[model samples]
Target: MSYLQKGNSMIRRTTAAKGLALAAVLSLGLTACASSDDGSGDSTEGGGGSSEPLKIGTILPVTGTLAFLGPPEIAGVGLAIDDINAAGGVLGNDVTVEWGDSGDSTDLSVASSTATDLIGKGVSVAIGAASSAVSLGVVDQFAEASVMQISPANTAADLSGYGEFFARTAPPDTVQGPAHADLIMGDGHCKVGFLVQNEAYGNGLRDYIQEALEAGGCEAVYGGNGEGHEFAPGETNFGAQVTDLLAQKPDAISIVAFEETTAIVNELVSQGWDFNGTTYFVDGNLSNYGEDFDPGTLEGVQGTLPGAQADEAFRDQLTTWYSENESGELEDFSYSAESYDATVLAALAAVKGEATDGATISQNIRAVSGAEGGTEVKTFEEGVKALEAGDEIHYVGKSGIGPLNESNDPTSAFIGIYKYGADNTYTFERQIEGKIEE
Candidate 1:
């Protein structure tokens, strides 16, 4: 069945001066030498005609608060590269990747420097910046350099139509937020409180969920956008925030911070607050806390994560690949499937356009995603074969997301609901499918 739903009823942050100067110089240089063809994806256009080797780059988190997401995401990229090369690579030349770090928003230097390095490397496609704030910090650099930036785990709603050069495999908060609100309301909670991180990801998601909650006749008693319960990034202390939220006498509370979730959880326990089934988590904090929290501490807690639940076959592939290549065990598999799809989609776009440059890839990305209707192929090899036979291919990747819409967000996606077990690890409960409103 097609994943699409009919009718779709559904940031530049400041950086150092050095990065800005470099990006400005690069943008001017590229514009000066740009081809007359307007990157319209026509075969006769100026940029989509090259057959050079596709060089991919990454700006994923290898350090900082969101570091837990790094393993699965990096593994996903490596696995895609392996598959692409094994299938004889793109345009008969082996694909290459330059790995870099996009540390969380706590330190802007990491993302800025890394983005500069990737853009300078002349990579055709850059694959990350997991945190929404981090991505916002460096998107202009990639956009200015005419490099396509595909993020596997950025979900801020404001990023929609940010530019022609930016795209993401993950559905925006527009899908996840309302879905999360439904989860809270479905369980009969009427008064909800949010202890959100005051950043792009947290603020945007808080707004959407709050809107849904109010629409459902539920009251957002505390932490409704700009109501002062929001915490800053790297905030290790949440005692006051918790105190403030509980004072609102809320029936449910959603914790929407990154690494700060641990501190918040601990504070909740200290306050003698009975969370269990009444507490909630979003994608940024839906982690396995078996080692962090005591047994049964989070037994009845539930959380929401974007993307469909991956099948066992794909899980095994990620597991096997990580074991053979990386050092530690793969723990949180939150965005692994999306990460794989991001890399594969970009590579497929390169193949479909018969070029490895960013402009060409951007033009063909939506087309290869089956936006115009085409044959469905699951694997990279199958997609290549189908494209070779003069067929427009729809890549049915493991993420189970529908084609990219006009905003470059997935037309439809699944938000997996998870419940914490006695071991403090979350297990899949069920998934809610949501269509992004076009």
Candidate 2:
């Protein structure tokens, strides 16, 4: 696809003055409103037109099965916009954002209508729809409109080449699958059982895990891809499935679903299954279940979540941002770092291409992501300075993900290993790095 040229010179002058004012305010180091609107509705006008602002739409899960992830992910986007505007905004204009709800795949209406509204708003780029299946449902709309869709938490393998306008900050299941399998086997499990959701995300990830498990001399005793044991989306009752899976008598059981994990865990408990040390969770279902389970119920359980374990400072920042902008305290920091990186990359692509249109951003996204060799920089401020100095840059953000590969998936990513404590909350234990074979 051809890139659109820059817009009117008058727009440049107006934005330049506005950018100067914003920079001046930043020099005072005071918190200020960054986006054009409050972050919900059409924040700013222009749908990738020559004289429009760089509008960003977010289709995050604010009210769905994955709502647990919405806080951190949304905070990540907000914080990135805050930082970008502080650094004089993108292309001399404050980046505007609109937030939409990406309800879980069980209900397609939420994400479908959200995508439609965002497209109608003329967003140049959209940040989420964290679920891979949800993204699959709405991605074609974004692509057809020349609007880039960047998912920070999608890991389904099939999404690698779904569209030219699509890219993800998170690595695909190919990287996460082996990493998780290695973690499980490294714990000395010879036989594993999976309680997988019957969806692309779970099924695709299950296949990779099965492959890796076999390669490691371990066995997936139950719920392998296409197995009848897999549960459908929105499945609530797990009595039969849990009993059948436990009938395999596997040493370890991995839950590869979303919010349904709660019911599954309860079923396992009801069956008197000894899961404390053998139960595992994937990103889709890994969460803080402090209120759901009794104290010590999940003790010693382990899980794997994608993205590097964010440092304390970054975590604190996300907490602060969420508190100031939204309602509650941020607890789960699952894909926050990846979400931040996705937003930063889009803004940097806008800077590199000197235009906010999706086509231009898409063309330059890979280059800014370091697919083309360049000076490595961290943070948007540093990258902007480097670009202003006529030097190419590769942005290294908090996610620690490698450059976008030819398929637009991260070439390498970090998988954080978390262990549950007595309170049913998981803590970061360590991280393993994996390179995508693609």
Candidate 3:
């Protein structure tokens, strides 16, 4: 297939952008306005005969409920940027980057403003806003602006076909949902009560878990979407929800939530529920709860998240780098590798297409992603060598996401099971493997 000619491509992209913009204006009736706190004011860089360098904007949640996730995600981005620049950046100019925060879906104002600001600054590619629903809220804006968007920790299946410009390293929750149910059932918890946040991530995972639990002969006792038990966003005070779940008297409870996990657990304890029974958790609230819970508060609890255990050596390296760049230490490494891989993939795509424009980058992403007929290269510098030698290169990163599926999602990933200790911190249990059958 022949690539679009530069002139013709410009016309098509402009027309597409205009149409998408019009559609956006007509459909977006959201009243809440977002404000971006961390973002760059750099000039746009792309195929418009501009000499400005390639610019990327990181929009992961740098604050709010998911703040525990910020460290490793930012570490992944920072490390990739350093590696790419050291290898002689895309199209001869060092890539420039801007940082922004996406609080959560509850507050669309933050991510919405961040996306608008990043698009205005001419960012060729945008990464993040970890929440699946949060990403959904503003993805069209990036798509219309012609900015390639990559998310590192979004797993909602609803976003599977969000747009041609959207890509995510995280596998949809369907892959891990069964693992969660199987683990709970296998542990002999025949009856289960589920407490979910009632959003994309929570509800989607809940559907799969319910099916698996029933299939395994376990009963889904309570808590489902619109069941009057589903927690509303920012609806704090889980007192009522806990009281309701206890009424079901299930042997086990499965919780998929964000920061609310801590509050929910506190409620459970206050109401005479013990963690001694099997209590399963999902990615959102799997962080260290030591500050809030007493020793042994979560001692036998289990949780699961997508992604294999990061290699020990790599974890040490990332920790050192993270501490130097941002703050204390790398505590939760949930999507760290995926974040690194997403950034690197975007950068390599920019190089392969020889343009920083969103459309151009998206067009060439496969060439650097172990596509058919491409020579494999493991590092950015190595891929650069292959490019210099006039060879198409397939670049693989630390995440091991090989190539993307037709949906622009990772072809392979792992679901890691974790067990909590006396200190309310989790330790790796086992990894469930996944791959697209086709």
Candidate 3's displacement at residue 280, Å, is 1.0
**For residues 1-438, what per-residue lDDT tens digits would candidate 3 score against the true structure?**
112121111101122233335335533543221112112212222333223567788788776788789888877887777777877777787776766777787887777777766676577788896998888888988887777889999988888767778998887776778888888988888878988887888888888888777778777888854465788765569888788888989899998899888788889889988786489988888888876888988999999888767888768777876776564778878888888888888877766666666776677676677764477887888887887777877777777665776678777778889999898899998888777433
Clashes of each: 1, 1, 2
Q: Which is superior by lDDT, 2 or 3?
A: 2
Ranking by TM-score: 1, 2, 3
Q: Model 1, stretches more than 4 Å misplaced?
A: 1-49
Specify the poorest-scoring 10-residue window by lDDT in model 2.
4-13
What lDDT does model 2 reach? 0.82
Query: What pairs collide in candidate 2?
Result: 47-122
Report the C-alpha lDDT of model 1 over 181-265, residue by residue, as the tens digit: 9999999998998888889999999999999998999988889986777888999988888888899899999888899999999
- Tell me the lDDT of model 3 at 427: 92
- Candidate 2 lDDT score at position 183: 83
In TM-score terms, candidate 2 sits at 0.89
lDDT of 2 by residue, 165-186 (tens): 8999999999889888988898
TM-score of each: 0.90, 0.89, 0.86
Residue clash pairs of candidate 3 = 34-109, 38-99
Runs of candidate 3 with Cα error greater than 4 angstroms are 1-51
